[model samples]
Target: MDATQHDADERFRGEVREWLEQNLTGRFAELRGRGGSGREHEDFEARLEWNRHMAAAGWTCVAWPVEHGGRGLSIAQQVIFHEEYARADAPARVNHLGEELLGPTLIAHGTAEQRARFLPPIVAVEELWCQGYSEPGAGSDLAAVSTRAQRVGDEWSITGQKVWTSLAQQADWCFVIARTEASSSRHRGLSYLLVPMDQPGVEVRPILQLTATSEFNEVFFDDARTDAALIVGGEGNGFKIAMATLGFERGVSTLAQQIAFRRELDAVIDSATRNGAIDDAVIRDRLVRARMTLEVIRQHALRTLGGEQGDGASVTKLLWSNWHRSLGELAMDVNGPASLLVGEEYALDDLQALFLFSRSDTIYGGSDEIQRNIIAERVLGLPREARP
Candidate 1:
């Protein structure tokens, strides 16, 4: 970039850093580094308040168009914002599913009325959202979803179960992909419906995890309803809209995620040094390799940030998920036998929690197997796998 652009980015970075430094004190001071991934239950109400605090200052949805209540930040500025947010060890955002995923989908595919109704609440942090894509039979094979929604007069009546829904219990709405045509199968005749979660027919049951937390949930919709006009991109267009949302899912925040991973890696190294595990030649080698792989992940992410969502995204997913899971394993080895035990009432230390939660890294956000299939068939132009 030119010197002018560099100076501009530096100025934006200063603004983000200064704001975070000032706002992350007083009542929010104790929230640094709290609530993320496997630990979403940590002071959730406090984190929600912090998220709203950022929104009121116009810090949320930095990359969205200015007409949509965002700053319309350039990609570089967005990167700077996320980096500074992570540097400050900011609490995990409470509305990422809304701000990062659904909000963009609405802007891309929703009717103007839908965007008018939803975008403001998301920008204001007055509403939270959860994805409703995966189901009992449709984890990675998303097109195999059996959840069904039927048009009834002015509304759509939805009935089905969604599994592995993150923060469903806390969400005010869900962007659901359900089969809207009874005779349809696979990718056809599906619709993306924005269903409110507080209605009588919806139930959210938290699924406890190995981390002793319920970051994930099973949501049952017994004739849960949404307005007929709430369908995004029209009926029978859910697959395209859902895929776009998934592409957004793998977008800009990944840079911040890698920074968090780096923090975890640093903590592991510190533990190894204090416990003398660093003396082990094997442990030292693994630590070096982990750092190198992280750099690879970061470079690949930057290269593909604004590019097409081809195999680049899948390749990045495979590289980072495997590397992260490996880092967790290395953390366990560094901790030695201590990793095998838990605290009173089964409390887990940081490394132990990392290892346990990282086990699912390769499985969620589309599994490693599914990502490899996308690369093999879509990128390599290989023969399609046989499907029954």
Candidate 2:
């Protein structure tokens, strides 16, 4: 970047750091380092309040356009902001699905009316959202989603199930991909509908995880209804819109995610030192390799930030997910035999929770197999995988 941009980013960094330092006090002091990944159940209500507090200060959605009530930070400034936020150990945000994924998709493809209705609440953190892309049969293969939504007079009635929905219990709305055409199959005749989560027809059943938290859920839409106009990108275009949302999913926030990963690594290193695990040649070598791979992940992410979307996102997902899963394994090794035991009430310490939760890292957010297939077929120009 140019010197002028560098100066501006530094200034933005200072601003973020200062604001977080000043405000993360009093009632919010306990929220630091709470709520993320396996620990989403930690101080959730307090974190929600903290999120709204940041929104009121214009810190949320820093990369969104100024017209959308965001600060309109440049990509460099956004990177600076996230890095500083992570440095401050701010609590995990409760609005990521809305701000990072749905808001941008709406800005890009939603009608003006939809933008006016949705964008403001997202910026204000007044509403929360969950994604309804994965179903029992269609986790990575999104085109296989069977959730059906049919037009009923002035509204659409959705009837089907969505599994692995994040934060559904707290979400106010769901951006769902449902089959709108009865005869449509695979990637055709689908519509991306914004359905309210509070209706009688919508059911959210929490799916307990290895972390002993229910951050993920199975949401049943038994004729759940949304306005006819709530469909994004128009009818029969859900696949494209959903793919765009997935592309946004892997953007600048990844830098902050890596920062969190680094914190976990540091903790593991500390544990090894205290427990004499650092004396083991195998453990020490693994730790060094973990640190090296993390830097590689960071560099790759920075390199591909504003580049092409699909294949680049796939490569990134593969890199970090594998790295993180490996880090979790190393954490267990560092903890030695104690890692096998749970605390009172089956409670797990952070490292134990990390080990268990990170097992799913390669499985969720498009599995490693799906990512490799995307890279092979799309990036390498290989023949497409034969579909059943």
Candidate 3:
């Protein structure tokens, strides 16, 4: 962008910074830095309130179109807002699936009526959402989804399971991909249906992790139904719509994620210094390398946000996932032998939680193996991987 645009963005950044500083006070001040990936269980009700506060202030969904209850921020402005939010240590947002992923997908692909129905709740933070994509068998191979949805008159009955569904128990709705056509396999015959979570046919069972937290859940649908008209992008086009959602998953918010990682890295460095681990040449070198890699990741994220996608999201997913997982390992190493021990009732420290949770970074959001295949085949013009 030109200098004039850059200056305007800087002004916008200052405005965002000022607003956060002014509003993130009193009750909201206590919520700063609470409720993140492994810590989603922290101050959740308060975070929900904070999220609604943002919605009321027109702070949520800043990048969405104005007609859709968003500020219609430019890319530069959106980046500025997120950067300021991270810098201020704002509470982690609870409605990301709606505001970021599902909202954009609807705007891009939904019919006029669908957008009118869904976008308002998302913008108002009145309804929460979860992705009904990964099943026990599906995981990263999205094409392998076996969730079945059959049309019955004006409604579609969906029956299947989704594992590792983030905040499934709390969501009022879920965007589900289920097989609507029989005698079809892989990516075909799939339909993206918006199913309600409050109905009798739906169930959620929290999955406790090594960290003793259950932010992820196993969601089951037993003849759960949504209106046939609720389908986004039409039947047999679920795969394409899902891919578009994944693209938004790796959008401008990545820059804010890196800022969070930087905070974690700084804490690890402080721990290393306190425990005399910094004196070791190996640990020190690794710390320096980590810092440099983070900068490179930030630069790549900025470029990807401004330019053509062109396999950028896959590359980014690989970079940050591996970098963050390594940071968790470094935290453990810095903590020395004390890291292995647990407090009363197996209570883990922050570093321990970081280490355990980071283990799944490579596994979720399209695994490292899947990302590499995309880069190889799509970016390099290599032959596609043979499917069994």
State the C-alpha lDDT per candidate: 0.92, 0.93, 0.92
The Cα error of candidate 2 at residue 379, in Å, is: 0.9
lDDT of 2 by residue, 21-75 (tens): 9999999998999999978889999999999998888888889999998888877
lDDT ranking, best first: 2, 3, 1
- The residue pairs in collision within model 2 are none
Give model 3's clash tally: 0
| Model 3 bad stretches (over 4 Å) | 306-310
lDDT of 2: 0.93
lDDT by residue for model 3 (1-388), tens: 8999989888998889889999999999999999889899999999999999999999999999898999989988988898889999999999999988999999999999999999999999999999999999999999999989988999999999999999998899999989999778999999899999999999999999989999999999999989989999998999999988889999988889999999999999999999899999999999999999999999989888942254678999999999999999999899889999999998998889999999999998889998999899989989999999
Q: 1-388 in candidate 1: lDDT tens per residue?
A: 9999999999989889999989999989999999888989999999999999998899999889999999988888888888889989999999999999999889888899999999999999999999998888899888899999999999999999999999998999999999999999999998999999999999999998998889999999999999999999999999989888888888889899999999999999999999999999999999999999899999988888862364568888898899989989999999999889998999899999999999999998899999999899989999988886
TM-score for predicted model 1 compared with the true structure: 0.98
